[model samples]
Target: MIHENPPLLTRIRPWVFVFDGPLAVGLALLVGISLVTMYSAASDYDGRMFDHVRNLSLAFVVMWAAACLPLPWMMRSAVPLYLLGVALLIAVALFGDIAKGARRWLDLGVTRIQPSELMKIAMPLMLAWWFQNREGVRRWYDFAIATVLLLVPVLLIARQPDLGTALLVSAAGLYVIFFAGLPWKVIAGGIVAGLAALPLLWSVMHDYQKHRVMMLLDPTSDPLGKGFHIIQSTIAVGSGGIWGKGWMEGTQAHLEFVPERTTDFVFAVFAEEFGLVGNGVLLLVYLLVIGRGLVIAASGASVFARLLAGAITLIFFTYAFVNMGMVTGVLPVVGVPLPLMSYGGTAMVTLGLGLGLLMSISRQRRLVQS
Candidate 1:
């Protein structure tokens, strides 16, 4: 009289169980939009677009793979994953490959790898696990310890002179700490201390780093040299106006005025082609993705899931915000990519992994509820 149970994967389906309905839909739309913009930015049916398609396909593969793993498996993997990340980072620092004056990559026989990218996920996962273990017994000392854990790799990255990724990794870790209920006074004090140490920090910065900040203050001071990117990108966004120039008809990108058109500066191309209206729509979609992430976080079955979900969501926000802000001349260029939109294999993979983790958390919540 008893019925046989369905296969594990089949039981979770309707496909939404793995993808999470709203998040999956939002991602589809975002990816579609990204492809459309990339085509225009690319200005031809060529290898660039094909490469993007390939990268996106790989990213989804990663997402699906991560989603299929059970929550306990992910939780158990956190420490080892984090330790591996730190070891890789140390390896990068000690005997890594140097390209373009930064020692951020390890040449692993077949291919070069950037270890800092691993910390983007590992830093948050490690912190979330730590806080989950200390759930009810959190103290100021614990928060300080969390900060140290967060800063170790951050300082290493900055030493690579990759201030952008360092900032991102730090943000990811800090989000977990904030979600764990770190005191406002501690946050405030850290801010004050950072501000107070600005002079010393400035002295220690590499010339290029110093130049970026200086250019942010007054790009016109060296318009032909350092200010070129901000100036051209801002012009592209402004030229887009209310309704855009109508897709590939964009003068900025077609004319090659917008630098890094397929990568970090891709937002300028999107803005130029689609205009203010397109930008608005894209922003709304990003907000929706973030909203879905927060919902997942709030509904998570465990403290670890909640913290990880929230951190990943805000990391998406930070990526988009920093990229847009830099392109618009509101912030200094720090080489951040517009999530799902920018053309880079590594960034795409990182984003996919984070979303996969979010999907895993969402799936866990649903399982708990059922």
Candidate 2:
């Protein structure tokens, strides 16, 4: 028998089915916004805009490849990835290149890699795998062991003075443990203990870290120095008013008042150009992505899938929340970039890996059900 070509959509359905619809829409919107904002934010820096686009394109590919992997393959690979990340962390501690007073990068003969970024995905993967093996028989000690696993890479990253990344990694692993039936009383007790340890935490903080906290409390104390970032970013955010200054018309970014306008503080550029209404729309898009992720997590076909999906979802939440909080001057600047919106290869890749895992879990669930 001879057949004519299939309908256009029918021919493409297999490719389209690889990604979750809502998640893809949300990511596309954010990426579009990132491109627009980058055009304005990086206008003064030749080639920066092209670099941003390249990074984002690479991220998209990473996400696509990740989504194509089987869940069983992901589970089988978890321990090896986790072990590799930890070993890399140890190597970083011993011989990583120092940049801006932080030893967070390992210089290979060709390219430098940030081992801590690997931990961002590996931590949650390892924890989810651990809990999946325990399944219904989990106990308090399981959590204790998991906590220890979480702390190793966290302490290593923190030793590099990369508090922002360490915090993100910690949150990722904790989300897995929490979703694996961690007790509420234990959570409450941990919070209480954390609060009680504030004094000791303060005593051990690096000088710059302490300064950041102080600046958060009062930016004017050192307005021209350590506080310049907060002050200028907050101005950019507030000056946008209800409707924003209009795209590419933002003075703070174009005038060079905002620091890191294309990277960590890109939100300030966005707020300045798009205004309050724009911020609301951006937040709504993020919420849509987050909501879709949680839905995927809830429908996960196995315990491992559920925990990994949930942790990865909340990790996105953490990225956005921390980045916006610091830009608005409500929190200390910890160098957390806005997810999918910031201009950085490492973060984009890490986030892409996360998005891929979410899509994979979601696709797997649909496959099993159908």
Candidate 3:
């Protein structure tokens, strides 16, 4: 029988296989190219699509570098990173330029940056670290304190009127709480309490948020206004039928019938061009990314590693699923992007951090014998 290497770095450095890293990279590359193509189609030959591709390429490189770094050091820096994220959020809230009736981004003169994007990683990282410290926190009150930790950022995010992002951050933190073996009874109790306090939450919701729910209930009531986005998206997706309209041929995108075609509604564009098969492929890529993540979680090297990796993994799943589901009329529309496939800076960085955690776990596994 042959034996694996016993050298420290030799045993550890090979963890990068990562369920066929080449295939994952190839698929990611294919998807990015597709997004760039869709961007051009939507732009009607604008130069901005080129810039989007450049940024996306840069994001991939950053993710690669992060994935190669060590995990313990990253976790050690968790508090500082979380504080930095909070500071950025505060900066955005206090002195940020306003756009589209929401103060969601900081104007860097050349480009706009959103801080809430960092919370997607920071929240999970902080919670995992918290659990690591309170290793024996097996009580309901401990879970409550954890919930408070999650709520603080959710409140800050909601104050930005970025409800979609607020919901996402909430989901990220909630994943940690749930994974901490939080009692099911407490969860059910919280659900009941939430339902009971629906009126209070509704009171705090921005007018536009309430209208989203209303429009979802009856798009026909306001076809030209709040309902327009969902209506256009459904038309674009449904028009694809079995075979799709073909790449760069979606009239919805070409004719500008689809809103946010290169961003929020990119899935609709992909669906319209590729039809059911394209959608199926997208789902497969997503499943592969998430499946590899879960495998890491199941065999993760430590509790912190497991929690951080698992939350990030499911958060990725949440991102793809929410974006696709919302675009397809199966879920309420929230502005969640489609992870690596979506064009954005903040989201890409978060995905990079997440990929780093997964790679960290994998690295630990390989180094186990060393």
Candidate 4:
């Protein structure tokens, strides 16, 4: 008699998948709505940005499809995917398409892809896979090796002069290390050491990067230059105080008060037109997303699955927090786009890979249950 594999299409923790499916779909819808409403205003109805929205939505669909794969299969494949991602990042550094003074995209004939974005998903996956296989073998050398793995891509991305994405990517890698349950003392010591090295790190930043930090401190210093983006974003956000100015009625976006209105500054447009209630509701949905990811993380099926899910969850959280923080004048402008809602390809693909890992984990847990 031949044994049949459990139906891949069938319920793997039926309720778990359903809960995830709705949140994922809802996030996409909300993002899609934001694109339509914001682009109309930001583009002054030119509607050229519609194609960007369409492409991004398509990317989200791709992400959802990846998420449907079995978790163990994802775990098994994480290393190769990660290495490929790293190789791409390296390739971009040497022969990349430069725009706006930074070479961030690699032209693969049909697509101009950002490899750094791939690293965001790949780093956590790599670390999780590394830590998962380690199991009961806890050694400083293992930690060192994992740190090196994290550092390799981080340094390469940093060389691309993409400090923001590099920071976010590093955080994703660190999530795996932290969740591997390393000692508190070690974590604390690393923080202290890092703080001490800030001085040295600051000295090495590109001239423009320092200017951005300076601009963050005093945006009025160059109100018409680097400071312009922050100034406009703040006005947009503050203008939408309570119930907001309402949808297409946002003067900030409509009047061109915000730069990068469709991408990094989308939150400002969102806050301006939707106000506090909209912001709160959006945040609630994001929290639910995080909560679902956490449930997957804490389930403890395997270190690889748990670590990958945790890193991806934290990546989502970081994207939201960092983007909002920059928009509201609470954080430095590091060019981190908002998750889902931001109009960008690299970011969407990164999110997709992470979601795919989550779905894979959920599926594995389901199979084990059956």
Q: How many backbone clashes does candidate 3 have?
A: 0
Q: Give me candidate 2's TM-score against the actual structure.
A: 0.96
Clashing pairs in 2: 244-275
Over the stretch 1-370, how does candidate 3's per-residue lDDT look in tens digits?
9987688877755544442363366447556645755564546657656756776677666666666666787779878888888888888889887888888888878987788888888899899988887786577787878888788778878888898899889999999888889888888988999999999998988889998888888777899999898999999999999889887788887898888877788888888888898788777777777888888787777778888888988998898889988887777788888776666666766676677667767667667745
**Per-candidate clashes, comma-separated:** 0, 1, 0, 2
| Model 1 lDDT-worst window of ten | 8-17
What TM-score does each of the candidates earn? 0.96, 0.96, 0.89, 0.90
Clashing pairs in model 3, backbone N/Cα/C closer than 3 A: none
Which numbered prediction scores highest in lDDT against the true structure? 2
Off by over 4 Å in 4: 1-22, 25-29, 32-36, 39-45
Question: Per-residue lDDT of 1-370 in model 4, one digit per residue for the tens?
Answer: 9987877666454533532554466566567556755575556546547766766767666666676666667777789988898889889988999888888889999988888887887788788888888999789988989999999999988988899989999999998899987889999999999999999999999988998899899999999998998999999999999999987888988888789888899898888888999899888878877887888788747777788788888988999899999998888899998877777666777776676667667666766777
Ranking by lDDT: 2, 1, 4, 3
Residue pairs that clash (backbone atoms under 3 angstroms), model 1: none
Candidate 1: lDDT of 152?
Answer: 89
Whole-model alpha-carbon lDDT for candidate 1: 0.92
Reference-based lDDT, residue 253, model 1: 86
Off by over 4 Å in 2: 1-16
lDDT of 1 by residue, 255-309 (tens): 8888899999999999988899999999999998999999999999999999999
Model 3 reaches what TM-score against the true structure? Answer: 0.89
Ranked by lDDT, the better of candidates 1 and 3 is 1
1 or 4: which has the higher lDDT?
A: 1
